[model samples]
Target: MVANPARRAAVTDAALELLGREGARAVTHRAVDAEARVPTGTCANYFRSRSDLLAGIAQRIFVLLAPNPDRLDELAELPVDDAGPAYAGYALERLLAHPNLARALVELRLEAPRSPEVAQPLTEFLRAGFDMDVEFHAARGLPGGREHVLRLHHLVNGIVLDALTIPLAPDIDPVTQAKDTARALGR
Candidate 1:
């Protein structure tokens, strides 16, 4: 079918917003069309099935979250000792900027195993971070490279989730914690 890129993006965005605000069940073609203020059948035309719609959301999530390639290259070129803190700062800034997108990601992950469309994006989304971490550490000659990156990933995920969803412990500072974790890993 002939496609209008802008329309497709709008539909995809509407689907994502629905997924973010109301969860997976709210992402039907009709709902997306309504949410996007498009004519009836618009989303259906763009997305042949629920799976297609989900895939679009997944792709959009990846695009929204993926770091800039130029920046990554620059980071790679930086002195090993300095790259880690820059990477950490970049991550924390993105997380803070898009809480809703992050929450939507958590929601999509919960649905990924049961939904085929979600599986690819979920895997790619996750692997992108893992691979980036490994590459950064490898470039910097950081010890425990992949393992340390993985640990930092888990740590940041937990801290972000907690800070976003629940009140933190009295002394727990998520930003400071993230910076500290990144500093430790970088060293």
Candidate 2:
């Protein structure tokens, strides 16, 4: 496989855009090449198959969504009671800021169950992230433990899904809701 980091990122980013805008079916190698403005077979060079392409996108989504370490340090300094909501709000804000990445993640999640190739890597990456969240929560002495973090994950996923699709509470601010929900869960 090629080792051009910039080109690889471009290919995966193009795939993400296609997944976000046109759904998973539109994310072919040729289509990605066109979207990335690269020559033909460029995406295929980075990802040999459709499963590879989807898995690569899944990896890229997490990379793009990862919280800033510096910000995490700042949040860690907050009072224990306040930190949870602050972190939750910050996370939601970051996720909402990249609408395309969020949509692509949703599409990849939907595809995971049916495609083992996508499911394996996606599940691994998700589990790793969940574990890190649990560790962070524990280290920060946040309001709850692993279960609380899991609940927060469910809440955030619901909120993001609603935001992306038919919003149930369109009038309510998602970031506020996230912070409030985190506070409630902590209690």
Candidate 3:
């Protein structure tokens, strides 16, 4: 049978949108079929299982996170000043584009290993972050040792998740903090 790339793309996009809007729990082969306006059997035929679909989506997300060989270009060098902060803006943009996806990723990470199916993207994403943090540290002449930089990266990740979990501040602008952090880390 000939594969229709457009049909597959539509199903994938529809699944992503459903996952984004309703969280992972809402995604099902049937729901995806309905959302895509495709045959229910078609969803199963293409993806085989929900886990497969999730893994495919997760891989897509990782690609988006890094976005090619120039993923570093997403952010300016370590010392992105108040004038031009590419990474800060990019981070915020990513979060805004699909905060729900971020939340789903965090939630699913715990159980990802249970299924070898979903494990690949989860591991890839985790490993990629570690590599990025290392490069992020090295880019600044190792101002802080590996451990210190790793600690900072963890802190940033935690804070981003916390900010999403509970909105304690009604008007907290992350940009200012990002600038302050850049200055502090640059030193």
Candidate 4:
């Protein structure tokens, strides 16, 4: 049978917290085990390799992104001035929910230079996210097709990247920032 889901979840949450708080270099198995309050070797027992742990963390992050289907749908429904701001707002909320997962996401991109297996999933995730945004934008009155979609996609990606990595005032509102950014971009 698979490992205990609760224990696994606890460990995953701890890992993400560590990732967000400590950066990628700090996500050690021992640290995760300690953070999860699991005994030594517990993390290793569940995730035998660093890559496996990272992949599992990714899975957990996707789950964390949407704990409830209704909430996920609601996330998709939040009105924005344009597609770029929508992406930014979503990205901000998702990132803020678990800073560690956000940090891991950025770290994963950096790791692309070292390995393809890790990069592949990140690439697919990005593409799928952009595709969803395309549909959302089209639904909201954007007339252009693929080319226009790419333009908005890239713009949002830049916003998300900056928002995640760049330090901002604690009170910065993602929706407001995204709206301003989109407007500045002439969206």
TM-scores of the candidates are 0.82, 0.96, 0.72, 0.73
Model 3 clash pairs are none
Overall lDDT per candidate, in order of appearance: 0.78, 0.91, 0.63, 0.67
Local accuracy of candidate 1 as per-residue lDDT tens digits, 19-128: 87788777788999999999999999988999988877888887788777787778777666666666666676677567777777778888889987888877886898
Best-matching candidate per TM-score: 2
Please identify model 3 stretches exceeding 4 Å from their true place.
1-6, 67-89, 136-142, 179-187
Per-residue lDDT of candidate 3, residues 1-187 (tens digit): 2388778777777777777667778889899899899976777777877888877766666544553335555343344343123354345446545676666566557548676777877788778777876676467454555665555555456546766677556377654454456446545
lDDT of 4 at 96: 56
- The predictions' CA RMSDs to the true structure, in order, are 2.7, 1.0, 3.8, 3.6
The Cα error of candidate 1 at residue 140, in Å, is 4.1
Which structure among the candidates has the greatest lDDT?
2
Which pairs clash in the backbone of model 4?
20-100
C-alpha-based local distance difference test score of model 1: 0.78
The predicted structure with the larger TM-score, 3 or 4, is 4
Model 4 vs. true fold: TM: 0.73
> In model 1, which regions exceed 4 Å deviation?
69-82, 140-143, 170-173, 185-187
Q: What would the per-residue lDDT of candidate 2 be over residues 1-187, giving only the tens digit for each residue?
A: 8899999998999899889989999999999999999999999999999999999998888988999999989988999998998988888888888888888888999999999989998999999999999998898888678999999889888888888788888999999999998898888
